[model samples]
Target: MTSSSFLLIGFIVYNLAFLMFVIAILGRKWAQDNPIEHTRKWGNYAIGATIIGLAGHAGFFFTRWYEAGHIPTSNMYEFMTFLGMMIIVAFIVVYFIYRAPVLGVFAVPIGIIIIGYASVFPKDVQPLIPALQSYWLKIHVTTAAFGEAFFAVGFAAGLMYLLRCVNFDSKEKGDRKEQRGVEVTIFSLVMIIAFVISIFGFNASGYHARFANDVLYTGKDGVEQTIKQNVDYVLPPIFKPFEGEQVEMKPFLGMTEAPFEAPSWMKGSNAGRKLNTVVWSIAGGLILYGLLRLIARKPLGAAISPLLKGIDLEDIDEISYRAIAIGYPIFTLGALIFAMIWAAEAWGRFWGWDPKEVWALIVFLYYAAYLHLRFSKGWQGKRSAWLAVIGFMVVMFTLVGVNLVIAGLHSYSGA
Candidate 1:
């Protein structure tokens, strides 16, 4: 009925699609007869569910856009949700092109994780700031997100290629290196999931903490003034703001206050809280990884490599390359060309070395290099797949890290 309802339906349906995809890919071994036919049947069910889920996701977007009287890409929650939706769109397109149900097995879960991560942000619709009040908001942000969505698909395929090909049991140096890289990637993903889980877990228990810090700011009168800024934390404070006073804190595990202060170099509005989140995510990820290792009694890669047994490594490698190839030009247009045009209109400058802008350039150049090496240098297979995976990380940092960690003209989007 409502946008939120539509989003919930989308989330649930996406999860169903993921499950169906898992069954489609993994069911072949368990099929009573005609494994190919079994996979085809379940794969069809998964794709159908995927389409239904996309409809719901689109419903959420359009309904929210109608309710807000603006495109729903102005803030963290809306943008992340839209990004997740676009990822689904990209996945669907790739699915139809390759007819690879296995792609769904990895890609759908990424969309789910993105939406789940998005839920951590505040969702209340708010009026756009002057900077975001432009037609380019619709064109630039959505295009950028859509391009990044394809990159997300590429990451999924690249990861699948690694898991499908890497020798998890071998003791050779190169094999071990690939194995560790996969493990680290898995650990990073676990950290993201862990952070989402921790946020929800603490929020459910009504955990809250606040710290007040005196920050020096330049006044309009060309004078410096000290202002007291308050930072809130939903998770426990492992590192308090530098020279901050405790406003309010809830004791947890006999910990009454943060054990350390954030480094002086960290100087954003919520740098300390962000740092603490990073720390917590790492700790939580290590714990989760350990639990998983204990259960499987081996590296996580080794455990996952089996599901990909019958998969052709070359096909997924092509999927990875093609996805990146298609996404690169879109990303260039949206993230670079359109972005610069918008920036010039909004701030009267075509290029500013704001952290966000710099990172956007970095993303553009990184992918540009990826394409050059892919087409010119004959870097395919493991090399190209690794590039695709790492390229998405660059895209993510530009989208997320620049917003949250680095204070700049684009910082308003973080709010």
Candidate 2:
């Protein structure tokens, strides 16, 4: 089968599995009269479908690798695709340990979401740059992805723990309106949906916001980049910066003589484009959240909690910690060690403290602290779970944000 065909099949299978898990979550009461047993069976059914999806994903992976004559882990599309698969791998491992049915409900959807997010980025399989044309490419990227996948699972478990345990009752904290875990869950969904929407909208409309002024800024490679004013891009700048060239320009509405000026430090590409993306995301997210709230007539977290009521919180906590513990060493070896070694060969230096490297260190240290606190200071349960959640956030920021910002030595992503 063609690689595209394989990927299409994989997408369908995973979405099917995701649907089944959702059904299993919501239909537990109607399944077999016993809630726990029925959901477990439903979760298993989802897993069965997930296994089939995984096979298709593997087919897609190998086919792409063969067609490209290299490991398919270079670009955002490739790495994110592999990362989705890793989440499934981590799910299988955790399931084997605790046999938690709730995990399938959470994990399968996560895989689907990840793969879906990956589809938004550029999908071309370009030839590797000189720096990435090494055997270390396979080792570093693959291992780092695997480690991050485990961390993703830990995030899932940690989130589930909070969703299951936290009371949904409203409480005021100081002068601000305090939100519950379920509310936060909705916010997260909004953000994800927003991101997807922004991606699609920008790509589909080919909308480009015009910059008001030409500006000179340094790129990640430390080269001065001249962004001429009155250029069109997808994003708009959030705030105007005083730096850069201030050339006179006509406004879109013929309102001003000078073009808009924004600092390059704000984002990777055009500041106006980045800003446009964020605005689109926020607008899209808020709309989706409002619809969900209207349809469910309750906070999403509150709605999901009952489905997970019978799940053992202790099991969730344990599995989350185990995932991090196992993943930490692997992440350390691959993302840091292998990464540094590869950097040394490529740039003739070990570490340059690039944005990517800094974020990598941040991810590693966050998890390291999590372990230290969990083991030495006895911070498990809620505390450890929160740490896992934050650690995964750091991992994600490194994954998506770094690539988007075009930071560090990982310029191969754009290649």
Candidate 3:
């Protein structure tokens, strides 16, 4: 099969595994089977399906790498898919160690969501830009992404622990505070789902909006000059580019123009377009979250927490900590040490304080502090789980937010 076919197969089987995992958890009360036997049977089936799916995912990676004549981690699309593959690898490791079928209930969905998110970006194989043409590209990027994959699994386990332990029915102040935090965590995930849905929905409808902004730059002769650049938006234009005018906009909701201009301080590459996408994602997320809340008649976290009945809280808490602990050293090696080596080779500097570089340091330092707190202050259970969840958010911002919202030496990767 072709690389695309391999990807399709992986996607299909992953969904199958997710269904099987759900059955493993929720089907224990069915008719005559012992609960343990029921879980074991279906969990084995789910794990078997997961292994097959992972093979297809790996096939897609190697085949695409051969076709492109370079590693497939250079751009957002390829990197996200690679990250999804590594998530499965990490999950498999943890599943075998814990023997917890319910882990699949949380982990598989994260892999599916990440793969779906990867589908939102362009998939064409492009020639490497000069800076990315080094052997370190494969070493540094793959190692770092593999480490981040463990963090994704850690986020899943951590979130699961929160859902399992938090008292959804309590009115105590501390319990209510934890409940709200869990609710917000669920909402943030919904926003990511909204972003993927909004992109696919708009692009499928061939929706298009364009704006032209005048950019001032220093010319070859060192004279100030201005040029107009076109910015395109697939979603409805909620805000125009900074000091930009409409080039074309399909009328929608009886509106022919954007109602606001991007703020002057928001001046990154395609900042207004990115801002508009963010607005759409948040609005769509609110609508989705509101509809779910109405249907469930409770906080979404509260609605879902019942699924974890009889689960071992300490087991999941340990899983969360172990996953983060395993990832920490790999992340240090790939994200900081190897990254600095590659940067120095390509740019003649170990560190230039570029936005990406700065954020990478921030991520490294944050996790270092996590380890410190865990070891020195005996921070465990809820506090440690919270740190794992928040640290993954930091990793994502370094991976995604910096790329989309900031222009620097690493801007090409965002493309």
Candidate 4:
């Protein structure tokens, strides 16, 4: 099937799986009260459906890459698709390690949201720009994106664990409190995710507007003659012609022409930037709400079921630590080492303090601090959770904010 067709099919399947997850969660109380034999059966079915949908999504991405003759991550649409795939892979790995499909209920929706965000960008197969014509582009971006995806799952689980921990003492209490707790947690999580996604959307849209305006007013000419004309018209006193007769002027007399035109590779960067602005704004609002709720000590209804109550916080913490342990070295190699090599090859400089690079360093440093806290001070529990939370923020900066806010040599890779 065509990639578009596959993508559509994948979207439908993913939505179906998402619905099943919601049903499974909503029916948790009924299953618990009724002692249904089919609970596990239905859960398995939902998981199978999710896996199938993920396969379809992977197929769609591979098809796109095959058609494009390179990685399909050179634009907003491609990056989002890749992110979705990475999230699923991470989810599967985590599920296998921890045997917790509950996390999937949180993670799959995030993948769906990423795919939905991708739909905002045009899906045309465009050629890679000169800046992206490097082997490291693939390695650096793919690995970093992979790390980000795993961290996203980590974030979801961490958030849930935090809520679960603060609200309940034991799994029994959590189970008893499941109904209200689950609903409240899900609601809060959704709100937070929505707010973050919306800000990105807004930022992307804003940048798109700015880029479009710049391109339109600049025209195809190398001269800023349009700007000069505006200056002449609006500020005649300052930009007045020399005190002489109206003589025919050279065509390129005004404005310092660029040695080269802006690369065609840059076409999507501004748009992505604008979208990120929107996403961040939305995220900011949700964060504010979450913080306020925390401060107010709002009592959300108990949502944990007896069976699902009281996660071994230590277990969850260990899972988070393992994820970082695996992800950190990979992230460092790809985002720092390989990225630097790519920069030197492409831009004649290894380090430019570009926003993307700065953010990568931030991610590395955050994790370094995490390790320091964990090992040096033997920190755990709340401190470790806080560190994990901070690590996710750094991951977000590396994944989304870096690409959107920073202008640099790697701009062509949609970052």
Candidate 5:
């Protein structure tokens, strides 16, 4: 099959499995009727399916890399795909220890949403600019993406805990409270899922719609001129269009004239930009369906559990702590130490106060505060949960915000 065909198939299979898992939770039935047995069976199936999906996703990614001849993460599309895969890998590791498949139901959809976002970008295998031609590109980007994936998982777990806590404490009591909690949880999940999907769909559709309008008005004669005009107006100096021949531009200030040619490698893969809109719409729809199932069940945590079997809240909490513990050091090394080294190598200085750099520092500080509040002040439960949520926000800022809003030295690469 074609690479795009393979990706489409993978997207369908993964999301379908995710939906089944959600149904299992909401129906209060797993592979069997009993909670432990049900959880064990369903959890295994979910993780197993995720593992298979990850393999397929990785295959798609490597295929793109081979075609592109460089890393696959030179733009937002590739970056989001890579991040989604990383989140699945992290989920698998956490699942084994926590044995909570419920987390996967929440986490996987978010990964899917990110991949949907990636689909918004043209799937062309564009070439690396001169600035992105260094070894640090691989190290810096891979580490940053890994950190973002971990942060995303952390966010999922926090949300799940919050939902579960609300159900447990609701004053209504009994079946009524349980029913109400389930409704509320499902509503929240659906709303969040819809919003994310909409963003991805809107962004992809908007770009293509605008491009189509431009083409209609400009016609074939103005195609080249239109490309040049759009490149001049829309692209930042760092991301100026590539023509075939070399044109002199200040690398530090960004591109002036477009490059003479797009790298030879990018030629056939530029699939019409509108294709992304179709792909995102389908992926986003599946994600929304899975979330709707989660919503319909209401009181997700309580419905699935008569008693909080095998999994302890404290244990789940500790698992999160451990994940943060392991991730924190690696994140620090990559975001702070390695990023600075790369900046110095690229820009002739270690720090430039770029938006990306500032956000990276902000993420670092946020996590540091998380650790401090947890250990020094002896905070836990809701307090720590709130901190974890905030830390993930910082990570998101470093990931999407840095790439999209605050253009900087690292902005040219993947989010």
Candidate 6:
């Protein structure tokens, strides 16, 4: 009934669709048999569920628009969710054209992971800051996100292309390549899982670590002073302040700056903790990755390959390139052109060398290089696929990493 309800329904429906696609992939071989009609049934249901979820996601968007009296692209949660929606949209478009249900195995999960990533951010709607109060908020941010969504799908396709196309026969170079690729993918999945754990931990603990005005802290000079901080859901200081201290006065762990008392430039006091948490998660993931390999005694990538034996890797590789080709100009227009316009209006400059802007340029330029290398240099198979993979990581850093680590002009407060 309410927008929140619609949003929940959308999340649940999309997750259900995600599972269906996974099922379709697992049962695809069975569905091809004349006697048993299962994969088709699951595939159709997945597609239908995906469409319904999109509608529900749209409902959430519209409801937020109505509630906020503006488009919902002004913050992390809204824009990130929109990005996830666009990935599914891109997948659907490709599906209609190619009829490749195999892509859905990777495509839907990519969207789900993105959506899951977005869910970890603060979800409450808040008034837009003065910088974001413009028509460009919708036009620029939505278009940029839509374009990057295609790129995200590009990453999925590229990964699929690599997994499906690589030669993995024992005692061969292909096997070695697949082993390395699988490690990277599995490591990525483990990082995601760790992030999910952090979110779950926060919710289960009802975590709210903040500092109101006049909060006491020892400055870098070791002098106790009253300060203001807006930290939320942050890990407590690794080394707490002495008894009777309201805030940790310790400023550094060796040369590294301590994860407290966010710098004045940061948009959120909690940014340090969020960034630290991510680093810890990745480090933990690496340990798990090593452990998994030790236990399994083989490369995870090669292990997963047999499940997708019938997949057409060439189709995936082509589609990966196509996704980038289709999305590049749009990304250029929205992320670069319109973004510059918005920056000029908001910050009195066309380009500020902001971290986010720099990363956006990096993503664009990397993909451009991928295109040139693919067409002009004829770097088609593994090399091009690897480029696509890297391009999406750059894009993701622009989207998520810039917010958490380098606050810049972008407001990640309560994000």
| Candidate No. with top TM-score | 1
Candidate 1 Cα outliers beyond 4 Å, as residue runs: 216-226
Q: Write the per-residue lDDT of candidate 3 for residues 83-195, one digit (tens) a residue.
A: 99999999999999998999899888888888888887778898999999999999999899888888888899989988988899999999999999999888888887888
Residues 1-415 of candidate 2 have per-residue lDDT tens digits of 8876887798898888878777777786676568677777778888888888888889989999998889999887888889988888888888778877677767777777788777776777789888889999999988998899889889889888877777666455621122353366557656776677666766676533343554677898999987755534433333333343323323334444224444556643334444444455667778888888889898777776667776789999998999888899999999999999999999998999888898999999889899999999999887787788777777877887665545456755741
What are the per-residue Cα lDDT tens digits for candidate 1 across 1-415? 8998999999999999899989988888889688889888989999999899989999999999999999999988999999999999999989899989999999999999999989988888899999889999999988889899999999999999999889888999999999999998888788888889999999999999999988889988999998999989999999998888999999989999999999988877688887887788889888888999999999999999998998888889989888888888888888889999999999999998999889988888898898899889999898988998888888877877776577788777753
Q: Determine the backbone clash count of candidate 3.
A: 0
Give stretches of model 6 more than 4 Å off: 35-41, 167-178, 211-227, 234-268, 283-298, 413-415
Q: How many clashes does each candidate structure show, in the order listed?
A: 0, 11, 0, 42, 11, 0
Query: Which of the numbered candidates is closest to the native, going by highest lDDT?
Result: 1
- The global C-alpha lDDT for each of the candidates, from Candidate 1 onward, is 0.89, 0.75, 0.88, 0.63, 0.62, 0.74
lDDT of model number 1: 0.89
Which residue pairs come into collision in candidate 3? Answer: none
Off by over 4 Å in 5: 27-33, 167-228, 231-311, 413-415
- TM match of model 2 to true structure: 0.83
List the RMSD of every prediction in angstroms: 1.6, 4.7, 1.9, 10.8, 11.1, 5.6
Q: Distance (Å) between predicted and true CA of 266, model 2?
A: 4.6
Candidate 6 lDDT over 1-415, as tens digits, reads 7777887888899889878877877876655664135766777888899999989988988998898788887777778778888888988887777777777888887877777777777777788888888899888988888888888778888887777766666678767766576567667876876676666665676544433333568878999987765443344333221121243232223522233443444334454465556666676677767777788787767666677776777788888888889899889999999999999999999999988889888988888898899999998877888888878878877887777677577754344
What lDDT tens digits, residue by residue, belong to model 4 across residues 305-382? 333452567777776776677677877887888888988898899899887788789888888888788888998775
Model 4 residue 329 distance off true place after TM-score fit, in angstroms: 1.7
